[model samples]
Target: MTFPRVQPEPVYRNPEAVARAVGGKARGNRVTVHAPGHKKGSPEISILVDPSAPRGLLVNCFSGEDPVAMKDWVLAKCGEPEFTPGDRSERPEPRAHLKLVRRAEPPKPFNDQYLVARGYHRSATYDYTSTDGEVLFEVLRYEHPTDTKTFVQRQPDGHEGWLNGRGDAVPYRLHELAANTADPVFVVEGEKDADRLASLGYLATTVPNGSWPEDLSVLSGRTVYVLADNDATGDKKAVVAIDRLSGIATAYRIDLPGLPPKGDVSDWLDAGHSQDELEELCLSAVPIAANDNAPPGKPLSIFEWTVDRFVGEAPAVEYLVDGVIPLGIPGMVSAAGDTGKSFALLELHRRVAFGSGIYAPPIFGGRVVSEGVSVMITSEDDANEVHRRIAALDEKGDRFSSAGKRMIVVPLPSAGGARAFWKEDRRLGLIETDDFKRICDQLHSIEGLRLVTFDPLASFAHVALNEDPTAGQFVCSSLARLATETGATILTAHHMRKSKAPIETLADAREAIRGSTALVDGLRLAYAMWPADEARAKRTCKSLGIHYQPNRIVLGGVVKANGAARRIMSTYARNESGLLIDKTSGLGTSAPAQDDLRTALVIAIEAAANAGAPFTKTGASGLFEMRERLPEELRRIAKGRLDALAAEALERGEIVRSAAKGEKTAKWLDVPGGLFAIGLGNFTTGAPR
Candidate 1:
C-alpha cells in the first residue's frame, strides 16, 4: 500500500503550518505509522495514509484530555479515496480542501497567548485574540512545501487564486471616468473621512497616514476644488494642501455652523445637513485675501452685465438733434477692404470732433458721448494714407496731428523690433483684444472714457476670415463686453467675409465675419459693407456706394442715421472728393422762376402725350405743395417767412436744367423698391453707360 507525501509543519512552509495555524497538534496516544489496509480507527474520521498522502491528513493518533478544543479546530482524521492518475497527473499530490462550519469567539488580546501556552497551536506574526470584541471574521491563507506563503485559496474548479490586490488593496483608477468630474471633490483629514464621504454623494479623498503629502500631485492639471473641514487639525492640513495647490486649481474651504469640537467633514455630513447648506457655507467663505489688499475704494459698483439697463454717471441724459436720432450710440463702422468704409468713418469722425457744419450723421447729432465723444483711435489704418485723405478733405493738405483735441490718434509705438512688425501685421490682430482690454484699464485710470475705435480688426488679429468663427465671435463678444465694462461704445473695425448670405442681418453677420463667428454674434451692432449691390445675394439692404465724408472724426465715426430701427436702406449719394454727399438726382434746390416752371410744364405737357396723366404736373408739385398745406400740429415751424429753398443746396453745386423755362424744381422722388439702397440685381444703370 502507498501513502501520500505529507509536507513538514512550520505551517507556511507546508501543510503542517495550516494545522498549527488552525490550532492542531499531534495526538497523545499515536500510532507510529499507517498503511492502506490499517485497522478501522475508533476516531471520528480515519485517515488511511499511503506514502503519497496529502500533507497533514493522516490517521495516526487520538488525543486524550486535550483542552476543550475549538468547535472548528483542524481535525487530522482523514479517509482514503481513490486518486485517478489523470487527476493527479499534473498535481504531484492532489487533495481536497474542506472546512467545517462552526461558531467561534473572535480573536482577542490574550487569546493568542493562551493558545501558544497550550501547545495546541504555534504563534504567528500577530498575536491571537482570546475574547471577541467585534471584527470576528476569519480569513485563511494557503501554503506550499517550499515555505511560500500564499494569500489565496483553492477554487471550486480546483484552480488556485489569491486575494484581490487590485480591488481592496489599492485605488489606482480615480478621476479616470467622465463621472468623476460630475462629482464634487471632498477634502477630508484621513481615510475615514473618505469612506464616510463616499457614503454621501461626494467623492472625497484624504492625505496619507502620516503628514499630508507635500504636494497633492493629482491636482497638478486637474480642475479640483478643495473643501477643507472646519477645525484646527483639518484647517492646518488644508493650509498644507492650499500651499501645494499654488496656481494648480481653484479651491475653497467649508465652514460648518456650530460644528462639533472635534468634528470633520463626515461629522457635518452625518449631522443630516443638505448639500445646499454645505454649498452656501462654501460660497460664503471668502478667498484668502492677501494682507496688503489696500484697494483705494470698493470697485465702483457697476453691474455691467445687464447691458441695456445701465445708466452711467451724472451726465447720463444725452440730448440729440432733430429727434430723428435720439442719441447716436457712437457705433462702429465696418466694410470690406478698400470699399471706402474707413475713409467714411474718418471723415465723419473728423466732422463730429470739430463740430463741423457738414455733419455726416455718425458720431454727430450733438450727443456729448463723454466730452463730445472723445475719439480714442488706435491708428489701425495707414497713418500716411489717413493724413493724405484728411488733407484732401480739408482742402488744406493737413494731417491728423494738426487736428488737436478734435482728433486723438494713438500712434503705434516707433520701437524698431517685433513690436513694430505687429503694428503692421494684420495677423497680429489678437493684440486688439489686449488693446480693448487695456483701453478699459486706461478708462478706469483716467476717470472716464467715451467712444473707442479699434479699426480694421485684421491689422491686429490673426483669425481666418469667414472660415473660423472665433474671430467674429471674439470681436463681437469683446465689443459688447468692452462697451459694457467702460460704458463706452466700442466701434471695432472689421472686414466683411467674401462670401455672404442673401441679405446680411446683424445675426447673419456671424457668417460674413472675417475671422471668428464669435465676433458677429457677440456684437450688438454689426455694420456690413459690400459693393452695396451684393452685400448679400438678395441685395436686400441699401446698396449705395460705400461712402465717405473726410470731414468727420479721423477713425472715430459711425454710419447709422436717424430713425434707425432694424431697417435696411439703399442710400443714393454722389462722391464729392471722397466725401459722401446726398444726391437729389434731378431735384431743384428751390421753386424755379415762372419761366423755368413753364419749361417743366411744357415737358410735362409733351411727356403726357405718351403717358396716362402727366400734364397736371402733380408729381413735380407734390412735395412743394405739401409744405404749403401743413397744419400747426403737422408743421414744426410756425409758418415764418420761408426762404423758398434750403440755402446750402444752392451754394456748392449747380442744379441740372429741366425740360421747360418755368418748371417747378423736384427733389429726390421716392419710388418703388426704395427700401434697398437704389442698387440691387441691376448692378448698373444702362442709361449712364
Candidate 2:
C-alpha cells in the first residue's frame, strides 16, 4: 500500500529559549528541525531555522537515513530542486504558507463589558427584540478610539451572525410599539435614532437592517411619520417606506431643514429643537396621499331627489339690467379691438355703484336695484389707468366719490406673475383657488354688492380659450357660482373678431364675438360692440354739423339674452370728452330740417337708380345706402325716424319707388320726371330740378 505524505513534527533544541524568542530574536544556541512536508518559510519558524546550518539541525536531531529522507520530503514540499547534503548554503528560500488563520468567536450577550474589553470604551448598544422580550439583534455604535459601528445577532442554536442569521429582523422596539398601538409611530433609518427619539418620549421604531423595511404591514391602520436622515440613503429609505405604507397607513415624511449632510433626528435634537417643536414639525408634514386633505363624504342615494327638497326653494331671478343681465349668472360683453369695451364696462360699473342712469336709451330700464358696491377686476388696465377711467366717467356728475368703498377695482397680475388658472393637477380653476377666494370673501363682506366685472376675460383665463370648451364652461360655471353665492351680478368682458366689413345689424355684431361658442352659450346674457358703418357715421356727423371721428361710433347690441328681449341695439358715440354717449337719440345739437331729409333721400334714390340696383323703401341695402348719403345729424336719429323721412319723400313725389321682384331685390326707383328731372344730365348746374 502506498503511504500518504505526512509533515513531520518540528524539533526544537532549547525549546524554552526558542519559545521565549520575540519577533525573530532568540538566545542560548537554539535550533529548530522542520519536518518533511512542513512549510519552511513561515516567519514564526524562520527565527529557529538558520539556512547556513540546515544539515547540523536536521542530522544532529535525526540520525541515520531518516534525516536524508526527511530532507528530500522537505524539498518536495517546498517545490525546490533536489540537492546534495552538503549543498545547503546554495539552497533557495522556501515559499511561505498562504492559508489564513481562523478568526476568534465573539462572546454571547455582547454588553458594555465586551465592548470595553475589545477597545470600544465609548459605545452605545441598541437591542432589537421580539414581542416576547427575546433579543433578536443588537447594534453597537462606537464613538471613541475609532468611529465605527457593528451589528450582531444570536441564532436559534446559540450561534452568532453579524446581523441576524434568520430571514429579516423585525423593527427595533417591537414590544413598545405593540404596547402603544394608538400612538403615532415615528419611523427612522437606524436603531440609534429610534432609541434617541424614544427617550424623548416619542414612540419611535426602525428596521433592523438599517434600511426601510421591505414590508411595512406592521404599521397598518396607524399614522406614521417618517423622519428622514439628511442624506441620499435616508431620503431613499424614507421614500420607499412611504410608498410601501401608502394604502396601509396614513404615512408622512418629515425632513428637518438646515441639517448637515448625513444628519439625523438625533442631530436635530442636538441642535436644540425641543419635543414641542418636533411635534409641530411632525404635524406640518404633508400626507403621502394628496386626497387625504379632501373633505370626507358618505355616499348618497339617487332617490334623495324629492320635490319637497327643492319646492320650498324658489330662487327669484335678480338682474343688474332687469331683463337683459340677470343677477346670479355670468354675463359677457364682447367687442372688437379699439371699440372702448373696457370704457363701456367701466361706465356700467360706475352706473351700478353710483345708482346713476345711463344718458342713452335704457336697456334694463336704466335703473339699478339700489346704489351698491361694485367691483371691477381687470387685467388689461393698471390701477392708475383704472382710476383715470373712473375719474373720467365721474365727470358725468354721478359723484362716484360719494359711493366711498363700494367701488372695488382690482388690477390683475401680468406676465411672470400670471399663472395658469387651470392646472393639470387641480380640478379647480384659479378663480376658485384660495387666492381668488380671499378676494371674493373680502368683497362679500361688503353689504349689498350688486355687480362684479372682469374686464377682458381672456387675460384671466389661462387655458386655450378657443380649443377647450370644457375649461371655458368650467370658468363660466365658477363665475356663475360666485354670483349665486354672493348675490352679485358678474360680467366679464370678451373680444370679438375684427370684421373687414362694418357691423350693420345686431345679428352681424353677435356673430363677430371671438372664442369658443361656449363663452356665449354658457352665459345668461352677452353683449357685442363693433364699429358702426363709417359712411353712416360720417353722414350723421355732417347732418348734426359735428366733426366725426371714425372710431368714435360704436354699435352696441344684445347678443344672448336668455331671460330677456331678443334684439336691443344702441348707438354709442365717444365724444371729444372721451365719454361714450347715447347717440341713437340724435346728436347733442339741433335736428336737421324736413326738406333736407327729403332732398337727401331723393339724392340717394337717384344715385341707386343710376347704378344697376334701384332703391327700395324697406330694404336694408337701400336704407343703408340712403343713410350713407344723408347728413351726419339725420343718421344719428333712430332708424324709425329715418324711415319716416323716406315716407315723406315718397308722398311729395320727390322720389318714386316700384315693386320688388324678390326678397333681396330692391324696388325700382325714378324721379318724378325720370333721372333727367333730378338734374343728372346737367351736372355742372349744381342745382335741383
Candidate 3:
C-alpha cells in the first residue's frame, strides 16, 4: 500500500525503485491512500491485506498517463514477478508507491543455428548464457514451464554443471540422460513425462537432444519406441519431426484419433479418464511418419575440370550445375605461412589452367587437354612472385604432367583511381565502367578458361575485413558474383587463424576466418587443414623411416604427425607406380602396385617401428593377437587389394612411429595416432586447459 505524502519530498526515484514501490496503479480517481504518520522525508507502502492470504495485496499507484493508456490498461495494477514485497514499516499506516520505467533493449541473437530456422518438431529448447566480464558461461535448461510442476530435478554425475541448480554450474547435459536403457525406449518432449515414464516401468525421458544424439548408450536397456505428439499432422512437419529422432528409438506416435480433436495425453488424464482408457491409448502407438527427401545421386568425383568431359573420368553429365556443381564441389584450401599459401594456389592453378592433370594423373606427366583454364589471382602477393611461381611450375612442368595445361593468370591491379563501389580495384580504381567491362572481355578472350584460383584473401579485399564493413561486403560479393557469371569454377584460399590445438572439424573453415563472416558464409564448398600432433609432427622428416617426408593429404596437413616407420616394400601392380614418380624429372625406380596381403604385412611389421621407440616383443605379441582377431577380410590371403597396400606400407619404412612421450598405449585415429578424441590431451607440454 502506498500513500502519497500530503507534502512530498524528492529523495531518489528511478525505474527500478518505482517498480519496487508500485503495487498497483489506478487512473483518474485519487483514492486517498490512508497511511499513518505520512512524513515528507520518509514514505512507506501500505499493503492491503487479504486477511486469509499470508501476504497482502501490495498497494501503490504506479505512474502512467491515463489519457495515453487504453482505458483497460489505465486501471490495471503492476507488480514484479518474483516479489516477496517485504513488510510495511510499522511507524505509520503505509501505502504502496509505484512508478514506471522505460523499456530495455531488444534481446540478443539466437545462439544456435538450429534454433534460427522455424521448425522444432518435438520441442524447441533454449540455451541461456551468463557472462561476468571476461568469463562466459552457458546453460541449457529445458524446463518446459507448460508442465514443470510434475518434473523434479535429480542428482547427476560426470557432466559439468550444477545438477540441482544449487551449486555453481559447470557444463550441463540438459538434453537427456545418456544411460544404458536396453534396446528401444520411449521419449517425450517435457521433463515430467520423461521422468515419470522411467518410473511407469518404461524407458523414457525428455530427450535433451536438439539434434540426433549419436551415442546409443541410452538405449542399452531397451529398444527405442519414440512416442510422438498426438496433435502434430502434415507431410513435411510430421516427417521431419519424427525423422530428426529416427535412430534413438523405433518411432511409434501416440494415436489419439478417437479423443477430442487435438487433445493431448495430458488433457485426457486431466479429464478424469479411467486407467483402462489411458492404457489403451499408450498401446495404440502408430508407425512413425515416412521420409520423402531421399538423397541425391552421388557425384563420381568431388572436384571437376573441363577435360573430365573428354577424359572419361569426370561425371560428363550433359547439364551443368550452377552454384555447387551438384556432387562436383571442389575443396578450397588455405594456409597461414606465405610460402605454403602461394604454393598451394600455384599447384591448383597449374592443375586446372593447363589441365596438365595435377591430381588427375597418367593423362599427363600431369595431363594435356585441348584448351587452357583461366585463373583470377586476386590475392595481394607481388605480381612478380606469382610470375616466378608459374615459371617454377613450368620448369618442373616436366616433373608434373605431360598435358600442355596453360593458365592465363590475371593479377588484379592493387590500387585504383576511383573504384566502382562494388568492383575489384584491379586498375587501382582507374577503370571507368567500360574499362572494367574490357577487363572482363580480355578474360573471356582466353579460350575455355575453366578454373580460377585466388591467393591471399587479404590482397583481394579492398578494405580491411573487420574495420571496413562496406569494403568487405563489396569484395566478398565480387568473388561470389565472378564464380556465377564466369561459369569457370572458382577456387580461392583464406588464411587459417592461429589455434592452440589441431583443427579436425570438417566445416571449421567458416569459424576462424578473420574477415566478415560473409566470406565463408557465401561459399559453396569448403575444406580446412592444420598441423596435427606437434610432438609427432616435428619428427616428420627425421629419417626414422624411408618415407617420412612432409607430404600433403587432401591439401591439408597436421602441424605435427604421428606415424610408424616403414620402407617402399615391393609392389605387385604396374599402374600404381605411374602415380608415384616425381613428374618433374620423370625419373624413379618405380615398382609394382599390388602385392598380396601376407607379403605386405610382413614388410610393415619388420620396418615401420623406430629404434627410437621400436615395438618390443610384448608390443609385437599384442599386434599378432590383434592381426589374428581381425575380420576375415583383414587376414592374409582373402584380404582385398587395399589391405595388401597397407601390408606393403608396413614392409617399406614409409610410416614412422612418432612414439608419444609417456604414452604406454595409443588409440588409432583416421591418421596413425592423432588425438584419441575431441577433448583428449595432446603435446608433451600439457593437456587442454
Candidate 4:
C-alpha cells in the first residue's frame, strides 16, 4: 500500500531565517524588523533566539507595542501558524562568546589635491600604526582660510593608494604602547593631545573621536591615566575609556585644572604647567578599578547534590550583635530626621568597639557577639562632632582608656570632601568610585575587623536611591560582598521617609524607610525608628512617672530579619548627651510606684490647664491628648492603665472633665480650684480595674 506524502512542519524559530523571510536585517542571533502589518520603513521589533539562553525566543517592541503581538506578526509573516508562536525547538546552536580582535582594511593612497580643491590647507597629520609600527591610517587636520578647522582620515591601500575612510582603528601609538609596559600611559581625546604629551617624554596614546580601540588587552596590568578635555563631551569620553579599561588596567581620570571651556591637555601644557606638576597630579589622583562593576564571565554550571551531602550538620547563623545584626551580612538602621539615628549608630559602634560591658545597656538590648575592631566612616559628621559624640557616649573616657586602637573614626568632611562610595552615571546607573575601593582595601588590611559603618547612606550612596530598585540592589549587594569577604557586619545609617503617623507595627516601621523597598529587602537585617504617636507617648510617660517630651521619645526595633527573630519594638529616651537609652527596662512595677505615677499624671494635667494648653480627655487634636503626654519609660505599660487612672480621677473629683466653652465634642481635664491634685486630700484610688 502507498502512503500519502507527509508535509514537513515549518521552522519559524530560527531568528535569522524568520528575519530574512520578513525582509528584516539579522546580525548574529538577533534581528530587527518592522511590525509585519505596519509600513516597512520604521523597524520597531527586535527578535533574539539562542539555545543557550534561558528562553530560546525573545521579542521586543520599541514603540510601546505589545511584544507578544509583534512576535506573532513576525511569525505569521514567516509562514508560522497562529498556535506555533510558542514553539522553540528549531532554534540555532548556542552562540560562542569571542574576544574582540583588530581587523584593518587596506586604504587608498593620500590625495593632497582633494583638500586643496576644497579651499583647505593641511596643518598636521597623525598616523595610527599597528603593533609592529606599520602605519595603518593617517588622520589629517585641515584648516580653512576662515580659521575653521576639521579632521579627515585616510588609510593606505596595498597598491600605495589612499582610501577616504579610516580602516580598522588602533591606538595612535600602538607599537610604543604595546612595547613600553612599565611606563604609565596617558589616553587623551584627540591625537593632538596625545602628541603634545608624547613630546614631553611621556608615553601617550589616543583613539579617534574619543572612542575606544578595537582591542585593548595589550594594556593589561598597566596603569592608564585618562585625560579629559574641558567640555562635557570630554568628561563623557573619559568615563567610557575608564569603563572599557576597568579590568585590563588600573585607570585614573586626571582633570587638568585651569583649562578653557573647550581646551585640552595641549592647551593646559601651553599654559605653562610643568611636566613635574602633571606627574604630581597623576600620582596623587586615586586609581579607579573599573572591573568592580564587570560581570563574572564564567560559563553556567549545574551541580547535582546527593543524599550523602546532607549528612553533615549545616553551620549556624552567626551574629555581630546577637539575634539583631547578623555577621558577614549587610544591615541598615533607618530613622526619620533628628530622631537620633546617627547618635544611636555611633553608640552601637562605640559599645561594640570598647566592649559594651562598660555601658549600662546594650544596643537594642542585643548583646555584642563579636568585639574586635570597628570602623566608622561618617560623611554627615565631622571630626569635632564625632569626637564630642564619642566623649558623650563614653563619659568615663573608656574609648581612650581600653583597647585604644579598637575604634577608627574617619570623618570624610575633615579629610576632604565626603567622597561618595558609589556614584550614579546617567548611562551606567551606579558605579563604584576609587574611594570605595581604597576604603575596602584599607579595611581588609586591618586585622580582626568586626564591623564597618557608613553614616547616613544618602551622603555616600550618590544615586536616585528612592526611585531606583537597581540602585538599591547595587548598594546593598556591594556592601554584602564587602561584608562576606571581610567577615564583618556592614551597617549603614539611613533616614526614613517623613511621616506623621506613628510606627505602631513592624510593617509600619518598614514602610517608614526612605528608599526603595528593595533597600530593606536586600538587607539581612533592618532596624527602624519612628516617633511614637501622641496616644502612645502619653501613655508611656504616665506609667513611667516621667515628664513627656515629644522629640525625646522614639520607638524602634528590628523591623526586618532574614530568619525567625524577636520583632518587638523597644522604647528609648534621648538622654542629656543625645544618646538613646533603652527605657523599657526601667519601668516602675510596684503599686506605690503606680500611685506616684498617677499622682504625677494628675499634677501634670493641672499644670497643663494652668498653662492654657489644657490636656484633652481624649482624641489627637485640641490641646495634646492624654496619651501624648506619656513619657518614654511608660511605653510598655498597657493603655488601659492610663484609661483607668483617668476614670478613677473623675470619680474622686481630683480631676474633673469639663468641655471647653462652646465646644461640645472636646473634653478638657481641669483640677478643682486649680489646686495640685496630689497635694489635695481628695486623692483616693485602688489598682486600675
Candidate 5:
C-alpha cells in the first residue's frame, strides 16, 4: 500500500557551534553574526535555530544584507551549504502536524533523575495537550551546569517514552481554554506565567515561542488580555499579538506596574503581587481600538544612498487575468445600470475559482493566470437573485458542482442588511467598520484564497465615496491592504455615469465611471462595459446581419491596465439567457466578405448623396465610383464585390432610384430612407443606362 510522502526533517547545527564558526556571539538558540565583508559599526544578522522550521534555521539581516546571500553565508559557516533560506513569515495552522507519523522509537520515561544524572536540574515542565486531553508534547525547563537556563521539548511517540523533537505547537492548556467559554482569558508571555495564573483559578494560555498561529478561531468573539514582558521584544510581541488577533478577538494590552527589565507575570507574582491587583489592571486596561496605531514622535533620519541597494532580480508582475486584472492589488469593473457589469464580475470570479493550472482558457476573453478559491460579496442581489444569476450561467449544473466548492458567494440582503465597509463619522471622519475587520479576519483564515470581489463599489463605500476624495482613497487603500495580506486580487463592481453618448475612447471610459477621480486613480486596473450607440449599433448589426435591439449588443475592454499590456476589446452579444457571448468572430472574413461589402455599399451610397456626388445605376459614375467614400474598415474591399453588393441592394430595394430635387429628369441611386440629392446636376441617370 502506498502512503503519503512525509517531508524529511531538516539537519540542524548547534547554535553555539555556528556562532563560534562565524565569529559571533550566541544568545540562547539564536546567533548575532556580522555579515561577510562587513565594515565597522555595521548591524549584525540574526540567525535563529528552529526545529519546526523547514530549513531548521531562520535568518534575518537588519543591516540590509541580501537575504539569500546572508542565508548562504550563514549556512556555509555552519558547514551546511546545501541549506536555503526558510520562509518564516507564513504561520501554519495550529495542530496541523497531528496527522504526521510519529518517531519509530518510543519516548523514554522522563523524570528529574534523568536531568540530575547529566549535571542539570529540572525546573519546570509544560505539557502541550490537544483538545481531547492528549499529551502531544512537553516543554521541559532545565538549569545547566554553566549557570544558565534552557528549555527543550520532546514529543510523545505514541508507545510511551518521549521523542527528541517536538510535536505541533499549540497554545498551552488549549483543552482547558476551550472548555471555559465564559471567563475572559489572560494571555501571558511564557508557559510558567500561564501556569501561575491558572494556579490562582484564572484561565490563561500562551503560545510556544511567541509565534502566533495563523488560524485562531477558538478565541474568536471572546475578550483576550495580552500581558507582555517588560522589555522591547515583549512590546513588539504585544503589537504582533494584537495585530494577529484583530478581527478574531477583542484584545487589550496589559502593562504590569513595578516590574524589572525583561520581567514577566511570573516575576510580578514573585514580587508578591496578588490576583486582585492583576484583575484590577486587566479591568482598567483599554481595548485595542481599530486604527489606533499612532505615529512615532520623531521622523526617521535619511539613510545612506547606494546605487546597488537592490539585491536581487526585479519581480515580475502577476495577474489573475493577464492584462485585464492584476494580482495582489485592487481593481475595478464598472458599467451603467442594467449593463450587466455585476454579472460580468461574478462570471470572472467563477472562472478564477475554477482555475487551477499554469494556464487556462480565457473566460472573459482574457487568459486566466492565478486559480484558487474565490469570494464574491453581493450587496444588491439577495440570495434568490444571486441564485438565479448563477444558475443562468450554467443550466446543466456540471460547472457549478466543481466550481462551487472553491467559490464563496455572500448575498448581503439575506445574510443581513448591507453594511458599508467605509463610512464617515462626524467625530472620527472616515473609518472602517467592524464588519470590515471581521471579513478580513475570515479571509485571512481561508487557505489558497485567490480572488475576492465586492459587487457594486457604491454598495460597500456608501455616499461618502462619491463626495469625498479622501474616503475614496481610504477605502481603496484599505482594500489594497486586504489584497496584500491575503495575496488575492480584490475586485469591485462600480456603476458608470449615466450618459446618452457611448464610451468611445479610454479617456471617456475613465470619465464614465462614477465617483471621484481618486477612485479611478487608486485602482491598478479598470475595465468597462457599455451598450453600443445608435450609429455603432447600426454599423455592427448591419455587418453581422442581425437586428439592432437596444442593450442586446455590448462592447467592453480594458480601459486601464497600468502598463501590464496594451488595451484590448471584445464584442459580445447578450444571449437570451442574459449571458454575454463574444461575437467578434463575425467580423473576420475576406475583403469581399458579404457584411463588409454590403456595409460599404450602403455607406458609400449615403455619402455620395450627402456630398452631392450622386452615383448613377449602370455607368462608371455608379456606386463603384463612390468606393473611396466607404468607411476605412471596408475601403479595402475589392471593386467587383462593391459593385455586386450595390446591384444587390438596388434589386432588393435597399437602394432606390429617386428623382433629383431640382432636376426631375435626372435620377440618383439613394437608400430607401437615406438623404436625397439636392440639385439637378448632382442626380444620377435612371436604371441600366
Candidate 6:
C-alpha cells in the first residue's frame, strides 16, 4: 500500500521559535516536544531541546539516534557541549545543557564634598581595630563652628555607614583590651571618651557606637568600670551592660555627682576633674553581680497546715504607744468640724515627745513607752498657729524638759511650699518624689523617732481621698511601711463627713470618717471625735458648775481597735485658756466637788421653804437661817459657794421667787414638785406656774 507523504513537526531552537509554536512567551531555558507516535505529553518519549541552540538552528534528531554521532554532531556544530554518560535504554532522548554568567554590580556613591559643605571636617579619628591590631573600621568625629558635632564611620571595604553598622566592629582599642585583660578597663559610651581616657594613661575601651554592644564576650574575665553618662538613657544603657556582663565579668557602674543630664566622662575631664578623682569615684561604685538581677527570694510560707509548725513560734503583739496605739501599726484620728481634734493631737504629741503619761490618766488608757522623738507634720496649721498651740501645751506644765528638742513641728507651707509627707511628679506619680525623699531622709536621720503624725491626711496625700480607693490604700500602706521600718507609731488625722445626724454609735462614727473605707481598713486602731450632745453638755455643766459652751465639750471614742474587746469612749474638755484636758481622768476641775455644792444649796433652800423661812433677798435673815439649817452634805461648803449655787438655781427657775411686793425684797422659794423639792417632805402635786 502506498502511504501519503508524512510532514515532520517543526523544532523550536530558542524563545522566539517556542513563542511562535505555542503562541505564548517562552517561560524557561528549556522546552519539551512530544512525537506523534508517543502518548501526547509523555515525558519519556519527548524531545529534550535547548533554547540556546548550538547549531544556531533547530535540529530534528530522533530519540533513538547513535550516541557517538550525536556527540560528534554537537562538537562539530556547537564548538563542544558539556557531556555526561546517560542510562543505555531501548529508546534514549537527547540530553539538554545550560550555562550561566553573572551581571556586573553598580558602584556605591560617595558624598565627601556634601559632608564638607555641611561644615564636617574630621577633628579626630578612632580606629576600631581587631584583636590582632588590624584596623577594621574608623570612626570620625567632625566639628563645626555653627552646627552641632557629627560622627561618621568608614570601613576598609569602602562601606560608609554609621559606626554602629560596621560589619567587623570590635571594641574600640581592641588590641589594648587584649593586652590589658588583667588590668581594670574603663568602658565608656563613645569612642571619644575611650580615646580621652586612653590619653590619660588609663586602660580604656568602648563599643563601636554610642550604644552597648550585643556581644560582650570580649569583656569576659576582665574587671570593667562602666562610667555611665548622667542621663536617663545613659543610665538605662549602663544598667543593661551591667546586667549582660554580670556573670562574665566583674563589672562596676560609676555615677558621678553634680554632672548635668547627658553629661559624660569627657565633660567631667573637661570640668577639671583629675585622674585621681576619677579613680576615687570608680572605687566608690558598687560591683554588679549575677544575684543583682535575680528576683527576691520567695517569702516564708504563711500557710500552716499543722499546729506543730506554729507551736511556740507565734510572735508577741507589740505596741508603739501601748494599748491605745499599737507599735509600728497605722492608726487614724478623725473628727468633725471644731471638735478639738487638733488640740487633742497636740496633747498626744506632747506626751510622745516628753515620754510622759498621755493626758494624765491616759486618753485611751495606754501608757507611753518612752520619751521618744515625735514628728508632727501639719498641713492645716501655719507656723504661727503651731507655735501658739505649742506654747499653750508648754503652759500646761505636763511637757518634759527635752520636749522642745525632741518634738518636731513642721507647719504647712503656704500653697506652694514643700508638702509635709507625700508629693507627686510627672515622671514619678506618687511612690517617692524628691521632696518626699528629703522628708524621709530627714526623719530617718533623727534618733529615737517613735511617733509620726500627719495632720489632715488629705493635705499630705497626693491623691483625692474619696475618688480613688487604691490611692488611699497606697497612702496608708506607705505610712504603715514607714512605721514598720522605723519602729514608729504613725497617726494620721482625718476629717469626718458632714451630716446633720449625730454619730450615736461607734459604727456610725466610723462611717462618718471622710473618704474611702480603705482609710479605716488600713489602720490597726482608729478613733473618732464629735461635739458632745446637748444633754451631755448640760449634765457636765450642772456637775462642774461651769457655764456650758457647745464647743468646749468634745467626746472621743475608739471606733476600731483591731484586737480589743470593745470601743473605748473618752472625753476632752477645753477650758477657758484653750487647754485640752482629758476628762476621762479627774485631772481637770472636780465635777464631784461642784455637784456636792449644788446638792448643799438645794437642801438648804428646801428646808427654809418648809420652815416658812424662805430667803427673801441676797442677804436677808431668811437666807442666813437657811444656811444654818443646811444638811450634813452642805455643812462643809463655804457660805459664799452656797449663796452662788442658790442664785444660779433661782436664775434657772429650779427655784421660784415670790412676786408679791409686800416684802422688802423678792422671797425665794423652792419650785413645787421640782427635782430638788421632790426630795423634801413638801411635795406639791400641781406643777409650778
- Candidate 1 vs candidate 5: the lDDT winner is 5
My TM-score estimates for the predictions, one after another, are 0.33, 0.45, 0.30, 0.57, 0.46, 0.49
The residue-level lDDT of candidate 2 at 150 comes to 42
Per-residue lDDT for 563 in model 2? 46
Off by over 4 Å in 1: 1-331, 358-373, 376-380, 394-403, 411-436, 445-448, 463-471, 499-518, 532-576, 584-689
Per-candidate local distance difference test: 0.39, 0.63, 0.38, 0.73, 0.72, 0.64
- Show model 5 residue runs off by greater than 4 Å: 1-200, 203-307, 356-365, 396-403, 589-689
lDDT per residue, candidate 5, 1-689, as tens digits? 44444454765768777778888856556778778778544347988777765457778898777787887787787776544334233223224445545475543444445456557787888898887888888888888878567566778767776666565567889899888888999888788889988998988988876767665766877889999899987887786787777777778889899989999999989999988998899897667656533222466555644647756644556878864577888888887778777777777776777653444334444677787899999989899998898788646574657666888889999997788887777665787775677688788878889999888788787647677888888988998889898999898898888877767755577788888888878887788888877777777777777877888778776676554332445577777777776675565542333543564465566656645666775567665554455555456656676667777877865567777655565457765644553232243455222
Candidate closest to the true structure, highest TM-score: 4
- Cα miss at 111, model 6 (Å)? 6.6
* Cα lDDT of model 1 by residue, 1-689, tens digit: 44565344421123333333433332221122222233333233223222333333333334332222311122322322333334443224434563335574332222232223333333122111112221112222333443433221111111332221111111112332123555446566655566565666656665432234443455444434455656666666775555455455455545577678767766776788877887777666544322122234566666756667746422322322221122324334555555566665565455445545433333321223233443545445455666676676666433334444545555343222111101223443433422333345555443334555656555545445455565556445545555565565566676765653432232343345455444454554455544433322122112323334322111111123222222222232325455533321222333333323322322222222222221111333332334343222212322222222212112312111122213344332211222111221111222110
Worst 10 residues of 3 by lDDT: 565-574
Per-residue CA lDDT of model 6 for 1-689, tens digit only, reads 43333333443455445434532222233233433334432222212344233333333445665545544444343344533445322113333443334463332332345457655687998888888997787787778888767666666654544322356446788888887767799888888788899998888887765545666667887778988999877876786666567667878778877677789999988988888999888887556534332345788876746657656433545655554577667789899987778777887778778666434655543566655788888887888888788787777554445457888888867435547355554554654333454466567678888788888887778776687777777787887777776788889898998878865556678888888888788777888888767877677666556788877777676777675212345566777657656565442343334543553465456445554455543544445444555555455556676677777867865466653223333354655442223332232344121
Q: What's the candidate order when arranged by decreasing lDDT?
A: 4, 5, 6, 2, 1, 3
Best by lDDT: 4
Candidate 5 lDDT (Cα, 0 to 1): 0.72
Q: For model 2, state the Cα shift of residue 334 in Å.
A: 0.7
Give model 1's TM-score versus the native structure. Answer: 0.33
Question: After superposition, which runs of candidate 6 have C-alpha atoms over 4 Å from their true positions?
Answer: 1-295, 302-306, 309-316, 337-343, 357-366, 378-406, 409-416, 419-447, 532-551, 575-579, 586-689
Writing each residue's lDDT as its tens digit, candidate 2 over 419-441 gives 33333234333334333544555
Better of 2 and 3 by lDDT: 2
